[model samples]
Every structure is written in structure tokens, then in C-alpha cells.
Target: MGPFVRRYAMPLTFLGLFAAVWMVQALVLPPDARRAVIAWASTNLENLAVNPVGTMVASAFVAEGAQGVLLVVAAIGLFPVTRRFGNLRAVVLVAASHVLGTLISQGIALVRLQAGLLSESIRTIPDVGPSYVLCAALVAAFLYGHGRVRRLLALAGWCALVPVLLDGLLALEVAAVGHLVAMLAGGLIGGLLLLLERRRVAVPEKMAAEPVAGA
Candidate 1:
């Protein structure tokens, strides 16, 4: 148990936090209050302008729809990435993807609004959810997961998520754009991490082999 916890601490902690927030949203808050909280936490343009970092970070932890299903999807995506990259790198990969996805999608919305292509209401549209993070993790894991089981889990996750995340991508809908960006960003970052990991291992092996070669 201890070894497992240490190995998968990032995913475990994330799921725990997600579960707690889900419980609060579902059980503790009434409909009105829940809506209020979700709005406040959303990464909408209004909130992003006022408090970018807070909203961006908060929005990733708050989600809607079927909680159990989301949790399972999150677990399937996150665990493989964490196991392959370790906790810190996995967190960096997902968090960076989330932030990039949100900023790019919202930035485009802002540009369209300014150019009269989008409505003013988009500034306050509720956009809170963990979909970006999950999308990113799924991409990274699918591309770079260590073994067959982990890779299959990621593939399954992608299949389940693609319809939901890519629904409005052609229309440049904010959520869909964000999810797409997150997936691309995650794949790129994961590739970089893989290269770095290989280089690190190669360097040490080369150094160790030098003495033997000289002898």
C-alpha cells in the first residue's frame, strides 16, 4: 500500500481532491448555490480578466455531469502518465496543458468578440471542468504509456472522450477548442519529456562506460 501510494501519489491525491469537490457540489450546495460557485470558479473571460490564475486552477478541479464516470476517466488517463513520468513531471505536463488550452481558447474568444464575430455573452459563459486536464493526460498516456495495459486504457479513454471534447471544434467553440489544444500540448510535452528521459539515461550509461573503454 505504501509503495503504491508513493508510486501513484499524484493521481491518488488528484482523485481525492476531485471527489471532495464533487461531493460538495452535489450534496452540500443547493442548485442556486452550486450554480453560483461554478460560475465563480469558471474560466470564463470575465473571471479570467479579474483573476486568471485562480480561475484557471480552480476550474480544473470542478466538474459537472456524471461524477463517477469522470472520476474513472481521470483515473485511467492520469495513472498511466504518472507511472511513466513520475509525479512532478506528470503534474507539470497536465497543468501546463490545461493552462495553455484555456488561455488559447479564451484568447481566441476575446479576439472574436472584439472583432464583432462573437457575442458579448461569451465573456461570462461558464467553462469550468476537468475535461482539459483529462484530455491532456489521455493524449500523453496514449502516446507514451509504458506497457500494453496502460496504452489500451488511454486508447479507451480517448474513444470515450473524443465525441464530447471535439463536438464543436469545427465551429471553434471554446470548450472544444480548449480540449483540442490540451491534447496537442500534452502530446508535445510528453514527447519532450520522453526525449529528456532518454538523454538522461544515455548520459549516465555513457559516463559509466568511459572507464571500461579506457581500461
Candidate 2:
């Protein structure tokens, strides 16, 4: 039981729970509820669309999840990455982080810290998926990863294209806050993954030369 919990069950549990929650909250909200929420969010989205003011509180909340997941991914990619806490720890940590983020986001929304109705069509929508995505890039860079670092980076580079796509999708309309939240979450997650990995990864050439030169 202990072994199973640590090895496969933990990570699987975390990923599974996270995927389910995100699907329900971000992707699969009740249709009527989703439409209403989207309508409200789109308003603030427009206000920041053109002259872009600031990120919605919800985006910041989502950023927390991105941070948490990427942090764990970075840890996993650590060469000596220890599974000291086992898979349970990793699973719990990521799951808790995401859940906490959602709670915070909802709390803020309830309080109306967000932008209210914008022009006619402006709306705010939270796409919290980017957090996991950028973390996946980190997972690629250091760990066995899905592919090589270059490929992961190529994936990270997708952020650049996102704006263009959003532009087209919006008809050059504004969802500035919504996209800002996405970009901010994406950049932060990717940057941290790289930074943490760099700090931990050894400079093989440097280490090798140290011994040769000394000898």
C-alpha cells in the first residue's frame, strides 16, 4: 500500500483530480452559469483590452496554481530529485495549490475586485489552463520530459503566437485582461521552471575541466 501510494497513485491522483476540477471550472461550467459568468467577465476584459490597465484578480489567482505546479515539476526535474514525500506529496501539493487558487479567485470575484461591465461587448474569461501547459514545458526541459528541451521551448514559444490567434478570434476586439492573465501565468511558469532548472543543473564541462586542469 505504501509503495503503491508513493510510486504511481500519488502523481496519478494529483493529475486526475486537477484535470477534473479544471474541466469543471474552466471548461465545463454549467451552460447557463457559464454564459452568465462569461458575460460578466467579458465586461472587465474590454476595459483592459485596448489601453490595458491591470490583470483581473482571478488571473492572479490562476497564476498561483501555475506557480505551484511548475514548482513541483521543477523539483521533479531535479537530477537528485527525491521522492521523499512520495507521489502523495506531489499530488497533494499540486492539487491543493490549484484548489486554493480557485477558491481565491472565486472569493475575489464575489467581492467584485474585478472590473465590471465594459463597453457593449467586453467580457472577462479566465483560461487557467496555461499554468499546467507552461509547467509541462518545464517538465520537458529538465525531466525525461515529453520531448527535448528545444521542443519544449518551441512549445513555450507558442505564447508569442497566442496573441495573434486571440486577435483573430476577437476580431481585433479586446479581451486584454483575459489574455494578460494567460500570458502572465504562462511566462511566469516557464521562466521559473528554467531558472530553477538552471540553478540545479550541473555544468558538466566546467566540472570536467576542473579536474583535468588541476591534474
Candidate 3:
């Protein structure tokens, strides 16, 4: 695929899926059905314990109201990474960020509960959205982002996202805390990937320079 298409394919796919789901939610599903769908797609500690894999993937594709709009904007920021690294990495980065973010945040909640900082009722709080993965990828793209424009766009996203995360943390919301943790995870993962890429290239060069074992 061409560079432009390679970069855009994943985001386009996401947008297409988003449109389909939006329509389904708006036109087809009844209010109760819609609520049921949202519940099914949620990836809270309770839900993850039951259907860990399902909620992770399902949550990514399910966006509602303002979240859908925010997701589209985040996807736009993520396109540069997709173009540079291809779709597979884009998906992996987002998925890892969301999953790991969920795990860590939930873990924190558990600790808080044990310490009496949080209530047992909080354990079942439904947490679903693209914020974790979206923040991670967008920040990662910025970290490894090529060119001034792409980096700036990444920065713009950071400015917008970080405040929300901070607000969430300040408000003692698990979901917001998860988003912040996930964003950091994304940045760390992006940095590690860059290092790994460098090492990968260097290893081949080192091998070429080394004498053959048989020789």
C-alpha cells in the first residue's frame, strides 16, 4: 500500500465501524437494548473477570455520545503512527495500553478498597471507553512522531488529554486514573519500541561484520 493509504487504513476502518455502531445505536436499538449493549461492552474489573478478552476488544469499538466524537478526534491523531508503523502496531499499541491500563487501575482500586479508601461498591463500577488506548497511541505517536507537524499534533492531544486524566485522578475516579496510567504506559512502550528497533537494525549490522563460523 501507498504511504498515505497505509497510514490511514486502520483509522478509516475504525471510523467506518464507528459509523456503523452509531447508526445501530441511534436507529435500531431500543433504549433498553442500547443499555444492555453498553453493559456488555464495558471493561470494568467485574466484567473483565468474567469475559476479559471480550470486554477489551468490544470496548474499543463501542463509543457513545461525546465519547464517539472524542474517539474520532483521537483516531485522527493516531493516523501518523499507523502510516509510519503500519496497522498491526497501531492495534497492538492501543490494545496493550487499554488492557494494561485497566489491570493497573483495577489493581489500585483493590488496594484502596482494602485500605478503606474506596468502598466495595466501587469494585463493580463499569469502566468502558477508548480513552486509555487512544491516549496511549496518541502520546506514543508524539514520542516517536516524525516531523514538526505530527509532533505538534501529538502535543496538542497531550494538552487536551492530560487535563482530563488529572481531573479524573483529582476526583478519585478509577477510570480517569486508568487513562493517565495508560497514557504513561503508551509513552514508555513507544520509547521501548524505538530502542528495540534500533537494536534490531544494529544486530544485523553486527552479524554482517562478524566472521562466519565455518570460515
How many steric clashes between backbone atoms does each model show? 0, 7, 1
Report the Cα lDDT for candidate 2.
0.38
lDDT of 1 by residue, 40-64 (tens): 9999999999999999888988876
> Which of candidates 1 and 2 is the stronger one according to TM-score?
1
Those runs of model 2 whose alpha carbons end farther than 4 Å from true positions after fitting are 1-15, 18-30, 33-146, 149-165, 169-193, 200-215
Q: What TM-scores do the predictions have?
A: 0.96, 0.33, 0.86
- Residue 2 CA displacement from its true place in model 1, Å: 1.4
Please identify which of the two predictions, 1 or 2, would achieve the higher lDDT against the true structure. Answer: 1
* Predictions in order: lDDT: 0.93, 0.38, 0.76
On residues 16-83, what C-alpha lDDT tens digit does candidate 3 reach at each position?
77667778988999998988888888776678779989988888767656755566667655786676
Q: Which candidate is the best by lDDT?
A: 1
Model 2's C-alpha root-mean-square deviation from the true structure amounts to: 10.8
TM-score, candidate number 1: 0.96
* Best candidate (score: TM-score): 1
Model 3 misplacement above 4 A: 1-8, 207-215
TM-score of 2: 0.33
